[model samples]
Target: KHILRYVRGTTNMGLFFKRDGTRRIVGYSDSSHNIDIDDGRSTSGHIFYLGSSPITWASQKQPTVALSSCEAEFMAATEAAKQAIWLKELLKEIQSIEEKVILRIDNKSAIALTKNPVFHGRSKHILKKYHFIRECVENEQIEVEHVPGKEQKADILTKPLARIKFKK
Candidate 1:
């Protein structure tokens, strides 16, 4: 009963999309380190935008526990890359020529890890699947850049934000 009420109340809400003159999809990823006390797993979040409006987004608990904050962010980024590739392909249906997808992550270390293979020793313990982002970066299918935590829209999804931040 409550669910239906919430849905009905929000039915009038809609997304506003404007042409930003940029034919590209951009994404932001964030993760909260070990927020799930029971499993010691982090929550991963990502949001993709077409122009200034969000096209797709996700927030979920990581499948595995990440030993460090960097690892948690790294894993979160890998998931975001997967979503970016999928969204990029979907964009091809309407636009034949699309620019490379860019993903913004707040963690500089994870961004660097995605670009260089020299961190092999540090990353070897991570699940092999999480390494998919490295290939995506090397192939130039997606580009990862650093975005400060305050500007990360996905911050709301990874963890609970203070009332002030939430209002932003």
Candidate 2:
């Protein structure tokens, strides 16, 4: 299978972490909207890194169906924010260091919704749980930022990629 080949081909590749001055916890959130043809649901993915090395990552199907790409991205960011909170608490307890948690999302609109408390026709129907990221941003627990699609590390977890792109 391709997975087996990939693993074999990358036998020498691995994540390497080094002691750095910055103790920032950076996260990337991404979603593939309407990827599930069965129910039109979306896939959510998140990856967190301590300094420049990845610490944790997750990819799962979303529970609810998102009506728009923005909604899907918002839900994904919410999932990532929950993990960020847990990581923040764990780091605080274990290392006694409060690091800056920044979650990068490629969707700018979703980032805006988190920063601004706004409701309209498009976002009114979204579940209240998806709004949790807004609270996270307001409390300064984590920052939701904008990242370009090509630089979105979580993209690999959300959707399938071509052979060339996958190698990258």
Candidate 3:
């Protein structure tokens, strides 16, 4: 089976956390727009890292349908921003995190929406709850950065990928 082969080939693979690795929290968020036929909802996912090692991650179906891929990605980023704020607060208990957490998103439109208040005609339909990410960005809690789709590691969590792409 494919799973057995995968397990056999990665017996020695593991995440190594360095003692002196950067303490900053970085996150990658992604979504598969309108993937669920039953409800017409999208799937959202995010992965967080401390230095180079993954610290936390999530993948789940979105509660509502998104009219566009941009909207779906924006919602995903909003979820990640919430998690980032929590992580920042938890880390504050031990040490100070002076820099805003960087949340890498693959969609340029979503990043623009978070940074700019001006909304497009199509974007007007998106719910208000998803707009919280914009507040987070403005408050210095998180920064949304555009990452090319090919480099988005959170893609694996949003949907199934081909073997070649999954390896990336």
lDDT of each: 0.91, 0.91, 0.91
lDDT of 3 by residue, 49-74 (tens): 97887889999999988988999999
Name every residue pair that clashes in candidate 1.
none
Please report how far candidate 3 places residue 75 from its true position, in Å: 0.5
For each candidate, give its TM-score against the true structure: 0.89, 0.92, 0.90
Which window of 10 residues has the lowest lDDT sum in candidate 2? 91-100
Q: Least lDDT summed over 10 consecutive residues: which range in candidate 3? A: 12-21
Report the Cα lDDT for residue 94, model 2: 70
Which portions of model 2 miss their true places by more than 4 Å? 1-3
Error at 102, model 1, angstroms: 0.5
Candidate 2 lDDT, 78-113, residue by residue in tens: 999999999989888877656568999999989988
| lDDT (C-alpha) at residue 109 in model 2 | 88
- Candidate 1 per-residue C-alpha lDDT over 1-168 given as tens digits, one digit per residue, 9 for 90 to 100: 999996897787677888888777889999999998898999999999987879999999999999989999999999999999989988898787468899999999899889986657778899889989999999999989999988999999998889788666
Candidate 3 Cα misplacement greater than 4 A, ranges:
1-10
Best by TM-score: 2
Model 3 steric clash pairs: none
Backbone atom clashes (below 3 Å) for every candidate: 0, 0, 0
